[model samples]
Structure formats: C-alpha cells, structure tokens
Target: MNFLKSSVGRKVLMAITGQLMVLFVVVHLLGNSTIFIGLINSYAEHLHSLGPFVWLFRLVLLAMVLIHAFFGIQVTLENRAATPQKYAVNRTLKVSLASSSMIWTGLTLVLFIVYHLCHFTARLTSDVASYAGQVPGDVYKMVLGSFQHGLISFVYVAAMCALCLHLYHGIQSFFQTMGWNNDTSLPLISCIGRALAVIFLLGYSSIPVFILTGILS
Candidate 1:
C-alpha cells in the first residue's frame, strides 16, 4: 500500500498504463487505416466476430483509460502544488506546451472518448440504425454517414489534434519514467515521440479529412 501510494509508484503505474494506451492507439490507427484499402467493414466484422471477447477487451481498455486518467490528474495536481509558479513561466516556453497542458488534453480526450463511443459504437448521436443492421456493409456505411457531416468531422479532427499533443509528451514521459532514457537516449526518445504523434495526427485525422473533402467517399 505504501509503495502504491508513493510518488514513484504512481508514476510507474502511469508509465505502464500510458504505454498500453499508446499501443492501443497505434493498433487502432492501423485498424482504422484499413478504410483506405476499403476493408473497414471487414475489420469491424472481425472485431465483432470476437464475440464476448470484444466486450471483454473493451472493458479492459475502459479500465485502463480510467486508471490512466485518474493518476494523470493526480500527478498534475501534485506537480502544480509542488511548483506553483512554474506553470506561469512554462506558458512562455512554447516547447513545453504539451507537457504543461497534459491535464487539459487528457480531459479533452476523456470527453472525446465518451462522444466517440456514442457516435460510433452506441449510434445514439444519429439515426444510423438502418445502416447498422445485419449487413456486411453496415459498419462502413455507418462510419461514412457520420463523417459526411462537417461538424462531426471537425470534432474528430480536433480531438485527434488533442490526442497528438497528449501523446507527444505522454510517450516521452513514459520512457523517462521507465528509466529507458539517459542523456544520450533522451534526444532519440523525444524524436520517436514527436514522430509517433505526427503519424497519429495524420493517420487518425485523415479519415475525417478525406471524408469531409469527398476523397474518401
């Protein structure tokens, strides 16, 4: 209990959960990328074919998100308390935007996750039940229908931006926390994080951008 309560322990937990979520993000992007090759419906079908295991995996992801968010907010608060004036100084340092805004970006992602689930998974945000019926093209049609709207696509793109910024710092911190970086490796890790963030930003945002612009339709 003491170990878990310690700052180091909490940071270690954050790193673990963050890395797992990063893996999910990468895999999710790849999965989503199938749309470019016209196999998104099949991908969705494969996920659904997992039966109860799909929900089981979703539950696990949910748990991971909750844990990551909880510890993230806590650590941010602790950091702020430990250095009240640091943030004011950090504001002028453009390079530290991702690190300083971790809490805000993280909260944004939480809201996006809820709305995303409602939009795509639960289909509660629109009347797309017809496209989601027992048909092979159901998933693809539903996604296409949703992204056809300008507002929805904009929101998705914006959320991806937030996700990119969050991961930009989150990945770097993960390496630092896991003791995977020294001075010599820090630059390489930073580059890796930035590169991954850019890939995610482009990869995830492309779906909406292409659809909104009619390139994906």
Candidate 2:
C-alpha cells in the first residue's frame, strides 16, 4: 500500500519496468538484424512459429508497456500541477527541443507502436502491396516490405528519432534509480547513456535505411 501511495515508489516501479523493456529492445534489435544477414525469411518464420508462446511474450510486453506509460503520465501530470508558472519562471529558457517536447514525441512513439503491432504482431494491416503480393512467408520479408515504401520508411526513421529522445533521458534515470548518480561518476554515466542511445537509434534506423537504399530489395 505504501509503495502504491508514494511517488518514489511509483518511480522505482517505472524504472524497473523501463529497464526490462530496454533489455527486450536489445534482443529485439538482434533478432531483427537477421534481415541484414541474408536470413530474413527464416528469421521471420521462426518468430511466426512461436504461436502461443509468442502471444504470452506479447502479453508480458504489453503489461510492462502499460505500467511504464501509466507512471510516466502520472509524473508528467504531477509536474504540471506542481509548477503552474513553469514557463513564466523561465521565460528565456532554451532547453533541448527533444527534452522539452517529450510529450509530443512520446505520443508519436505510441502511435508508431500501435501501427507496428498492426503491421507485424496482428497482421491486420499488411504491407503486402510493396512486396508485390510476395506475402513475405516470414518475418524478414514482412519487415523489409514495410520499409520499402517511402512513407513507411520515413515513419520508422522519425519514430527512431523520438526513441532516441526517450532513451536520452530514460537511461540516465534508470541509473539514478539504481543509486549510481554521484559527482565523480555522473559524466561517465552520461556518456554511457548517450552511447547506448546512439547505438539504438542507429540500429533501429538501419532497417529503414537498408530498405530505402535498395540494399535488401
């Protein structure tokens, strides 16, 4: 009850869930990278074959996503309430656009996630047109086909940009939650967070780039 009642407790819960999702992203990137290795079809089919297990994994993933989003919204609302004159207090402030615009970018990401699920996890909105009705037969082709379209590719790149903004803050917050924010270690931690954020952006963006360049077509 105390944990549910306290802001710190909610933040700790969010940090734990966020870190778990980050770990999932690392594996998801590796799994998706098979498309670059010339084994796209096999990789796609492997994912497709998970059947009930895939749904179970998805359920867990959805739970984590909801928890993270809920706490994040709560925090943002509380911040707005606590600082009614935040803009007035800093009329000339020039924060990083991404940092100041987290809510907008975050909404974009949420939409991207929904579209992504509809495209892959649900197969409700297929990218069959780009593949010329090839049907992909596996994960690689489906994913590749989705990025082959110019509009879709741009969407992915934009989403990756938003993801970079989210990670830029999220990663450091995670470390701080684990009690690693000290003067001597702050710079090192910040560097590591930036490095990881850059790697993630590049990794996720590479798929769209590869498709757009005709490298995988």
Candidate 3:
C-alpha cells in the first residue's frame, strides 16, 4: 500500500502500463496493415476465432488503460502542486511540445480510443449497415466502407496525429522512468522514439487516406 502511494511507484506503474499499451498499438497496426495485402478479413477472422480469450485480453487492456489514466492524473496534479509556481528558468521551454502537453494529449487519446472502439470494434454506427450482408466478420469491408466517408477518414487522420504526438513523448518518458536513459544514450533514444512515432502515424493514417483516395479499393 505504501509503495502504491509513493511517487516513484506510481511513475513505475505508468511506465509499465504505457509500455504494454505501446506494444498493443504496434501489434494492432501490424495486424491491420494486412488491409494493404487484401488479407484483413482473414486477420479479423483469426482474431474472432480467439473466442473467450479475446474478451480476456480486452479486460486486461481496459484495466491497464484505467490504471494508467488514474496514476497519470495523480502524478501530474502532484507535480503541479509541488511546484506551486512557474519554474524560475521556464525549463519546460526546452522540451518538445509533445512532452509539455502530455496531459492534454493523454486525455485526447482516451476520447479517441473510445470513439475508435465504437467505430471499429463495436461497429455500432449506421455505417455498419453498408457492410451488412457481407460475410459474418467481413471487417475489411466494414473498414473500407467506413473510411470511404470524408468525415470519418478526416477524424481518423486527426486522431492519428494526436497519437503521433502522444507516442513521441511517451516512448522517451517510458525509458526514462525505467532508468534506461542516460546522458550519452538519451539523444539516440529520443531520436528513435520520434522515428517510431512517425512510422506509426504514417502506417495507420495511410489506410484511411488510401481508402478515401480510392487507392485501396
């Protein structure tokens, strides 16, 4: 209980959960990229075949999201309370915009995640009707049909931009919290983080863009 209340412990928890979420994003992007190869339906079917285990995985992910958000808010508020005044030197100016806006970005991501789950996973929109009469789990058609809408594709691209900014800060913060960053390696790690964030942004954003442009149809 004491550990849970400690600042360092909360940071550690955030780091661990953040890493798990990152891994999930990477794997999810890779799996969804099968759309480019015309195998997304197969991929979706394989995931559906997981049956009860998929719900178990989703429960674990939900727990991670909640815990991470709770601790993140607690830590951020604690930091602000501890300072109580602006930094004498305004050191935040030295950091990247993404690093400075972690709280806002995180909150935005929470909303985006909820919308994404409804749009893709729950298929709870009228848009799903267009893909009805297809195979039972024709996720590819659903995805394609959904993205064909200018507004939906625009929202997806905008959310991905937010994701990119969030990831750019998150990756470096994860390493620092884990005690893996050092003066000599910090620059390299930051660069790698930015690179990975861009890659993810492009990879995920391209699907919607391509669909909207009729390149992937």
Candidate 4:
C-alpha cells in the first residue's frame, strides 16, 4: 500500500495501463485489417461473440483508460503548478506540443471513442433499424456504410490524426517509465515511436481514403 502511494508506483501503473491499451489497439487494428482479406464478417462475429466475458474486458479496459488519463492530467497539472512563476532566463518548454497539449487531443479522442462505440460497440447506428431481424452482420455493415458518407470518412481521418499524435508521445514515454531510457538507446526508442505513429496513422487513414475514392464500392 505504501508503494501505491509513491510517485514511481503511480508511474508504473500508468505505464502498465498504457501498454495494455496499446495492446488492445494493436489487436483491434489487426482485426480491422481483415477487411482487406475479405473476411471482415468472420472477424467481426468472432469479436462480437466474446459472450459475458466481454463485459469483463470492457471493465478492465475502462479502468486502464481512466487511470492513464487521470495520471496524465495529474502530471500536467503538477508541471503547470511548478511553473507558477515565469523564469527570468529564457527556457523552452521541456515537452513537445503533442505531449503538452494531450488534454485537448485526448478529449477529442474520447469523443471519437464514444462515437465509435455508438456506431460499432453498442451496435447502434443511423441504419440499425434496417438491420432488424438480420444476422450478426451488425459490425461490418455499419463500418461499410459509414464510409459511404464523406463526413464519416473525414471524421475517421481526423481521429486517426489525433491518435497518431497521442501515440507519438506515448510510445517513448512508456519506454522511459519502464526504465529503458539511456543515451545509447533513446534515439532508437524515438525512431521506433515515430515510425509506429506514422505507420499506424497511414494504415488506418488508408481505409477511409479508399472508401471515399469509391474503391471499396
């Protein structure tokens, strides 16, 4: 319990939670990529049938998300508090805008997450009624149909943009929290962070772009 009260403990918890969330994202991205293999429905049904334990997974994910967000906000607030007085000497902010401005990007991502849940997770959609008495095509059809609209595609692009920014800062932070930071290894970690961020953003963004171009039609 004493350890839990320590700053290092809180950071460790945050890192663990962040890694869990990243793993979930990786699995989700891999699952979504099945659309390219022409078995999106199979993948969707597999996910949809997680049964009662799905709720357990959701709860775990929720806990991780809230903890990570709370700790991030706490750290940002602490930084702000520490800088209550302006320094006489000119000094650049130690963090990047992507890192410092995470609260706004995070809020935008949360909205996107809620929108995604409404459209996919909760199986709610503008055309849900049309899917009545239908089989478990709930997930696939919604994603396919949403892309038919230019606005939805644009929303996806924007969300992916924010996500990439979040990941760019998050990946390296995770490494540092894990005690992996070193002069010899920091550059490599930084490179990996940028590469992963760019690749994920481009890969996810490609889906909406393809749809908007009528390639998926």
| TM-scores vs. true structure, each candidate | 0.92, 0.87, 0.94, 0.89
Overall lDDT per candidate, in order of appearance? 0.87, 0.79, 0.89, 0.79
Which of the predicted structures, 1 or 2, would earn the higher lDDT when compared with the native?
1
Deviation in Å, model 2, residue 76 alpha carbon: 0.5
Question: How many steric clashes between backbone atoms does each model show?
Answer: 0, 1, 0, 0
Q: Which stretches of candidate 4 lie over 4 Å from their true place?
A: 127-129, 132-135
As for lDDT, the candidate ahead, 2 or 3, is: 3
For all predictions, the C-alpha RMSD in Å is: 2.3, 2.9, 1.8, 2.2
Worst 10 residues of 4 by lDDT: 127-136
Cand. 4 Cα-lDDT: 0.79
User: The CA-based lDDT of model 1 is what?
Assistant: 0.87
- lDDT score, residue 163, model 2? 87
Q: After superposition, how far is residue 60 of candidate 1 from its true place, in Å?
A: 1.1
lDDT of 2: 0.79
Superposition error at 60 for model 2 (Å)? 1.0
Q: What is the lDDT of residue 4 in candidate 4?
A: 62
Worst 10 residues of 2 by lDDT: 128-137
Task: Compare the candidates by TM-score and give the number of the best one.
Answer: 3
